[model samples]
Target: MYRDLTIGEKGKDVAQLQKGLRSLGWPTGADPSGTFGSGTAAAVRRMYAAMGYAAPLTASAVTPSANAASDAAGVGEGGEQPGSDIEMGRSSATPQPTEPESTVMLPVSEAVFVPSLPARVVSVPVQVGDTVKGPVITLARGDMTLTGFLDPSEQRLIRTGMKAEILAEATGVHTTATVDSVGAVVTPGSGADKTASDSSAVTPQNGSAYVPVKIKSSGRWDKKYADQDVRITITAAATSGAVTAVPEAAVSAGADARTTVTVVLTLNA
Candidate 1:
């Protein structure tokens, strides 16, 4: 009275066979299409093997009784039943707690990062298992620049666009650079007015006045020089043509607050 589903067959009976295979965790290629194909034939052989049947199926024909056996194995075509953990090859008599399925999703903006320009990561402030409270990573780009601090008197002479000489003591490389910028504000106790090429270098101390200055090389700078101490000499001023000079001792301030230079004249007899 029950019909057998075989390859090349179509209609609702073939669809039932496909559903039965899927219920037993043997996928029949796709959703029940009501037409038996090569995929269905392969799944039929696998199903027969799982059921401990040594005899090969006839032309991949699935009998109605076999569909009933598959349904009883674990889950029905409709849904999963209580204590029906057939995928594990076992079943429990007592009903177990069913955990609800959970899914987590994040917004596109929070999930992706788009930087304004091309950059390279300099450092990561956190490690694995550390909670992120502030900045996670630092990025840098473009040419490298040198940062140095100067005393108030020296700062007054250094200005942006001035030519500077750079010397790396470690490598003995001398290079020409230009003053990129000069900080207008002076912080106090800023330790010794030293040059720093990285973040770990000497920092400003409390109550010391020091102005920060930035200098950039005129040409390509080697990355190996980064973070190393370097000497910077900025040409505060320059002049051309002949000029008058005098000794330090001869130059003096008069009582009237006027500068005067002592001149020595030799008489020829």
Candidate 2:
């Protein structure tokens, strides 16, 4: 029984997704703007791999037809038989290979900085002499918003009131503060060439529909720096314990995707 089969960001937006999902049978009440929410993910997980959309979390992305069903449940470590490879040469001294290991699950996130918004500087909202808050962030708008989303599995890694160091864009000076809000409203849509880090490419669909975050606090800005932009850094949560973890820096594609590992080793010359 396939429930949620979302043809999301790669397709429509969240509301449209929800509508389409409902039309397709899994009525998540999700807005099809292509947002990746709890309702949509759960539905997809149950309905996906079985329908061949993707594979389940495992030791590798490259699945094995002969071993997949056997490995479906957790394989023991070192589950290989060296003798099986030899043709009629049964060696009593061969060692067995290890079984597949369990995978660790972590919440991944994409970020948006103040400069990344399609809103543009549009006259820096604050002036140098004006008072401002410490925590500052900007949301993207448009087709990208609906397509760009943070998996709900990653929600636990981010939180409100987390401490964030802030920096002004023009002056290159920075300050410190704590987070005040986490938007429950996710942006929908994606671009062929855009990424979480590309500021200039994040233009919104409706133009004025971006949800830039306004930090709430009290501090006087150096008047000369009022027109500058701000940026914030948030901490990512940890999901350690025999699970797979690929550092974001190691991935070449802006780490825009995730997958299981088949082999990990170092060649010692």
Candidate 3:
């Protein structure tokens, strides 16, 4: 599935999606966030039309879509999801993740540099074909950021405080992540727009203009990705710390029976 595919921190998935549609003349008008959303779906539908396909599920905005809210889901169980042209033709010989060909209008790749071993020298081992995971910025230190443009025919979810997933290429092992931040603005991808920050090497940056949330990691979160294909899922959720763990199958039983899982708390004091 390789959902995580951004190169560095702040990878622009939405913009890339929108830009693809724009290239096809649909125009999503959304700057990429490297995060998939409503606008991205619309873009995919537009692409499908250009490819001569009938109104696809995504484009059928009238009826509620099952995977409507989801973005960049990985290949399913060693096979592509049915009805998705992009995955159906995936080459088994060189099996790997690929965006749905029928959905994506155009593809865009940004050039990036990977840090060399010993954390001293830096090199650009992977490029276009490679993928990335969450916050490529934190790992691709010293690397620059690339922002994408938008087209006119796009939509957005625009729910502030709602969670989102990120898929980025990593430099090391594992390429997946959870939501670490949320949007404060409600953008409909009809040309969505949106920030601030500082620290006294530790304190906080007193802003001069409108301020943006500035959160400093406690250094506990993952940060190994540098230049690899990664997948992120912001949709799935659990309580902080996942205090109560349960198998996926158990979830339904737990929900239907109103089973209350205990949240054990231990104080070291």
Better of 1 and 3 by TM-score: 1
How many angstroms is residue 84 displaced in model 1 relative to the true structure, after the best TM-score fit? 41
**Window of ten residues with lowest summed lDDT in model 2:** 104-113
How much lDDT does each candidate structure score? 0.63, 0.43, 0.36
lDDT per residue for candidate 3 within 3-83, as digits (tens), equals 332212134444554455565577544535564544655665666676787543311113323353233233334455566
> How much does candidate 1 score in TM-score?
0.36
Q: Which model, 1 or 2, shows the larger lDDT?
A: 1
Return whichever of 2 and 3 wins on lDDT.
Answer: 2
lDDT of 1 by residue, 94-204 (tens): 234444422221112221132233334567798989987987776676555677767767867887899888889998988888888887555544433333224444545
What tens digits encode model 2's per-residue C-alpha lDDT throughout 1-269?
11222223333334444554455576454434556455665554545544775523435233345444344322232454544443223332233355664332112221122222233222335566767765233433421211222344555655666666666677788766555554443343533223332444344445332333224333543444343445655566546568766776555533657653455589999
Clashes in predicted model 3: 43
Candidate 2 global TM-score = 0.27
Global Cα lDDT for candidate 1: 0.63
